[model samples]
Target: MGTIKDDASLVEQALLQDEESKRYTGDGSVDFKGRPVLKQNTGTWKACPFILGSECCERLAGYGIGINLVSYLTNKLHEGNVSAARTVSTWTGTYFITPLIGAVLADAYWGRYWTIAGFSIIYFIGMCILTLSASIPALRPVECLGSICPPATPTQYVVFFLGLYLIALGTGGIKACASPFGADQFDDTDSEERIKKGSFFNWFFFFVNTGALVSFTFIVWIQDNAGWGLGFGIPTLFMGLSIGCFFLGTPLYRFQKPGESPITRLCQVVIASVRKRDLVVPEDSSLLYETPNKSFVLEGSRKLEHSEELR
Candidate 1:
C-alpha cells in the first residue's frame, strides 16, 4: 500500500500522497516502494462494472425481500395490513440507521472494500437463513383458523427477525461503502476520470431501478405463483452472483487507505464550538485554520476555504 512520511500531519500526508500519485506514473511513477499506482493501467469503465453489477444484484436481492413481504405475512400467516406494515416499517428504520454506524466504522477503521465485503458475507448468510425459514415446513408460518391467524411463537419470531436484521446490518454497511468505493476507481485529478465518476453514479441509480423493476415484476410474481422456495432462492442466487462479480474486479480496482476518524472530528468540532461560544469572532479571514497544502484539504471530501459564510 502507498503511504506518506510518518512525521507529517494528516493534511501534509494527504498532500504528499496526492502529489506522489499524480507525479509518479509509468517507469517514472511512484517512488520509494516502486509499485505502480495502476497495475495494468486499466480504464475506469472496466473496473467499475463489477461493483455496479454487484450493487444491481444486491438491490435485486434486497428489494426482492421487500416487494412481497406484506403478502407473505397476510396470506401465509394471515396478518392484517396494519400489523405486517408496522413490522416491516420497524425493520426498515433499523436498516436505514445501521448505515450511519457502518460509515463511521468504515472511516474510523475499515477501508471501504473490507467493510463492504464483510457486510456482504453477513448479508448472504442472512438471506440463506431467510430462505430456510420460508421453505422449511417447520420454520414457515402456519395457516390461520378461519379469519384469525395466531401470532408467531417466540421461536419463530426469533428465527425470522434474526435473519431480517442480519440483512439490514450487511446491506447498511454495503450501501455506505459501495458508491464511494466505486468513485475511488476514477482519478479525481483527471478531468476525464472525474466525468467518468459522474457517469458511474448516473448508471448506478439506473441499475438500482432496474433491480427494483425486476423485483416487483418477476421476483414478486415468482413468490406469488411459484413456491416460496424458488422465489426467495432466485434472489439468493443473484446475491451469490453479485459477490462473485465484486471479486472479479479485484485486480483492476484501486484500493484506498483508511484515514482520520470522522467521529472524532465531529466531536472535536462540537466540543470546540461549545467551549469557544463566549469568544469574540475574528474579523480577519486569515486567522482561521486551514491546511498549508492545496492538494489535500479534506480527508473525506474537499478542503474548506475561509469565507464570509463563516461570519
Candidate 2:
C-alpha cells in the first residue's frame, strides 16, 4: 500500500509517509523527544508515582537538613544562639528566594524537565559536601569541652556553608518546577484528564506532608541519638534517591515547551500602559484587543476575556 501523509487538507500532498496511528494527547504536550505522545501509554497517574516519590524523598531530605540546623550550628560549630538563629534565617530566605531564578529559567529557556534534572545534580553534590563536612574530622569544628568552646575556624565555616548554599540552589529549581511538571502529565483539554489533574494535586500535597512528617519525626531523632555524620548522611543518601526516582520515570513524562519570559511580558505590559496613560477608556468591553479565534495570542494557552476591574 502507498504511504499516506499527515497533511490531509484536500486535493494535495497525499504521497508522503503514512499518518501515525496513535491517538495523540490533545493538550499540546509531547514526549521527552518532542514527538506526539500516545494518550493511553504516557502521563496521567502512571507517571505521578515517580514524581511523588521524588517529591517525598526531596522534601524529606530538605527538612532533614533544616530541622536540626540550629542545634548543629550552636552545638557543633560553637556558634552563639543569636548567630546561629541569624544564619538559619538567612539560609532559609535564600533557599526560598532562589526559586524565582528557577521559575524564570524554566519558563524562558530550560523548560521544566531539564531545569529539575540539572538542579538535582547540584543538590546532590551539596548534600555530599554536607555529609563530608559532618563526617570528616578536618571539615567539622573540634568538639567542645566543659564551659569554654573554641569557635569554628574559617576553613570549617567555608566547607559547611558551601554545601548549604549549593543545596539552596538545587532545591530552588526543584521547588519551582516539580508541581507544575506533575500537573503537565494530565491533559487540560480532556475533561477526564482535567478532573484527574485536580486529584493529582491532592495526592501531591499528601506526599509533600508525608515527607515533611518523616523528616521532623524520624530524621530529627536520628540526628539526636546518632552521630552527626550519620544524621546528615541519611538525608544525603535520600537526596540521591530523589534524583534516581525522578530519572526512573523520565520515559513516562510529558513535556511542555518553554515560552517567552514572564518578566519580559510584565515589562511589556507596564510600558504599554505607561504609553497609553492619556487614552480614554472604551465603554464597550469588546473594544479591547482580543482575538476571537480558538487559539490565543500567546502560544500554548487559551484566550482570556479582558476584565474591566483590572483597568
Candidate 3:
C-alpha cells in the first residue's frame, strides 16, 4: 500500500509539472485548423522566416516594377516625361489606396491569411501579363530610331495598363495584411513572445529594405543591360516565390479569426451614446456594459474596461 501511494504521488507531481510548464496563449489565435495552438509546437521564430521570405520577395518584385516604370513608360510606351511621371504617380496612388479595401476585407470577413493568399494570386496574374506585354512583340509598340517613336496602339495601352492596375490591386491586399499577419504569429499575452513580436517588426523592415536594395541595384541593372522581358520576368518569378513561401507557412500560421464589422460597431456606439445623452453618469464604472469574460468577447476583439477619461 505504501509503495502504491508513493508511485501515485510521483505520477501526480509529474502531471502537475507538465501542466505548469505548458500554458496556452490567452489570445484567441488558433492554428490553421481552428484549434488551440501549443506554444511549443507552433508560431514564434519558427514561422517568421517564411513570413519574412514572402514579404522580402514581394517587396523585391513590387519595388522592381515601380522604380523603373517611368523609364518603361517613356522609352517603351513612348510617352513624354510629364506623361510618364503622371502615370507612375497615379499608379502609385492606386497601389497605396487599395489597402483600404484589403483592410476591410481582412478585418470584417476573410481574416489575414486568406486575404493575403487571394491577393497574391491577383498579383501573380498581373506580373505574368506584364511580363508577356514586354516580351511579346505584338503587345508593345515598335522599337524606333532617334526621338521619333511609334505611339502605342489602343490594344497595347489596354494590355499594359490592365497588368499595371491588377498589380496595384493585388499589392494593396498584400500590404494591408502581411505585417499584421506576421505579428499574429507571436502571442501577445506571452511576455517573451511579445518581445519577439517587436523584434519581428524590426527584422521585417530590414528585410523590406533588403528587397528594395536588390530591386534598385540588381533588377535595375537587369532592366537596363538586358531586355525588358527578362527584367519583368525575373520579378515575376520572385512574386511566384513569394506566393510559395506564404503557402508553405500556412500550416504553421496562427490565424486570428475575423470579427464583427468595426464600422457597424462604431455606428452602434454612436446611436447608443446619443440615446443615453440625457442619462446621469454612474459613479461606479463597473455599471458600464462590459463583458464579464476574461477571454476575448469576440474572436479579434477584447472588451475594454470603462474609463472615466474617455467619457
Best by lDDT: 3
Report model 2's TM-score to 2 decimal places.
Answer: 0.89
Q: Candidate 3 lDDT, tens digit per residue, 189-260?
A: 778898999999999999999999999999999999998999999999999999999999888888889998
Candidate 1 lDDT tens digits, 34-110: 24466346537878889999999999999998778888777765668999999889889988888897797777787
Total clashes, candidate 3? 0
Any idea what lDDT model 2 has?
Answer: 0.89
- The residue pairs that clash in candidate 1, if any, are 24-29, 25-29
Weakest lDDT window of 10 consecutive positions for candidate 1 = 24-33
Each model's backbone clash number: 2, 0, 0
lDDT tens per residue, model 2, 33-147: 9988888889999899999999999999999999999999998999999999999999999999999999999988998999999999999999999999989999987887788
- Using TM-score, rank the candidates from best to worst: 2, 3, 1
Q: Give the C-alpha miss distance for residue 140 in model 3, angstroms.
A: 0.4
TM-score of every model versus the real structure: 0.81, 0.89, 0.88
